[model samples]
Target: MKKIAVIYWTGTGNTEAMAHSVADGARTAGAEVAIQCVGDIAADTAAGFDALALGCPAMGAEVLEETEFEPFFAELEPQLGGKTVGLFGSYGWGDGQWMRDWKERTIAAGANLCGEPVMANEAPGVTELDECRALGEALTK
Candidate 1:
């Protein structure tokens, strides 16, 4: 089975909900999934997974959560070469600029993106949850 990690950080719990949806989908698709908070994981832990689903809320002027997620991601980025990565998040404002920037960063890090990054305006609903699931299934592909 594919080893997949669903790693994320949440402020208002929207992104945490999204992460669970992603993990559920990956599990359904027959992947071994580890769903974890960003703070609970080490950067090198990413290397053990066949694919990654990363999540964080868009914070402060359309950027990633500065304190925890950003620094964790920065450490993980350099190790992403040839890795399969999927991204999802929630945003309160802006035109999904954070996701755009994140996608660019992932590409620059040499990750093989699994699918389009998934984003929801606030709390994700049924549609957004389904999309997150699809993104997870893509990681197994």
Candidate 2:
């Protein structure tokens, strides 16, 4: 089975919920899944997985969590070339500029983006959850 990692950072638990939904979809698709917080897994850990799903909520000015997720992601960026990568997150405000920027960055890093980055306004609703699942499923393809 393909080994997939679903890594995320959550402040209000909204992104965490999306992470679980992603893991569920990966599991259902017959992939071995590892779900972890960004702090628990190092940037190099991403190399071990066949595909990766990363999540982090939008922060000030619609940016990634700078103190943690950003630095971690920067470390991982160089490793993304030719890898299957999925990005998702929750936003309290703003027009999802973070996700758009993130998508572009991931592509620039040479990753084959699974799909459009999934974004939720606050806590994800059913639609968002389903989109998260689709993101996970895309990794299986």
Candidate 3:
């Protein structure tokens, strides 16, 4: 089975909810998955997974969590040369500009995105959850 990692950082459990949906989808698509907070993920552990799902809620002034998630991504970004990557997150306000910027950055890092980043305003609702699951299943292919 393809090994896929779901790495995320959540302040209020919204993004965590989405992460679970993603894992469920990946499992349905026959991918072995590892789900963890970015803090728990090893800095040098990118090579073992065929696909990666990164999550971080929008933080102050519409940016990724600078201290943890951003830095973790910065470390991982440098080496995503040929990885299948998916991005997801929750946002409190604004028009999902953070996910947009993040998607652009992912492209710049040489990763192939499964699709446009999946996002929800606060938590994954019924439709959002389905989309998140589809994102996970697509990562396997």
Best by lDDT: 1
Which regions of candidate 1 are displaced past 4 Å?
none
lDDT string for model 1 (1-141, tens) is 899999999988999999999999899999999999999999898767999999998998889999999999999999999999999999986899999999999999999999999999899999999999999899988
The lDDT of each candidate is 0.94, 0.93, 0.90
Q: Cα RMSDs of all predictions?
A: 0.7, 0.7, 0.9
Candidate 3 lDDT at 75 equals 84
Which lDDT value does model 1 have at 26? 92
Segments of candidate 2 deviating more than 4 angstroms: none
**Clash count, one per candidate:** 0, 0, 0
Write the residue-wise lDDT of candidate 2 on 1-141 in tens digits. Answer: 999999999999999999999999988898999999999999997777999999999997888999889999999999999999999999986998999999999999999998988999999999999999999998888
For candidate 1, what is the TM-score? 0.98
Candidate that beats the other on lDDT, 2 or 3, i.e. the better one: 2
Q: Over the stretch 64-138, how does candidate 3's per-residue lDDT look in tens digits?
A: 999889888888888887889999999987898888899998999899999878999997899989988999999
Model 2 TM-score on a 0 to 1 scale: 0.98
- TM-score of each predicted structure versus truth: 0.98, 0.98, 0.97
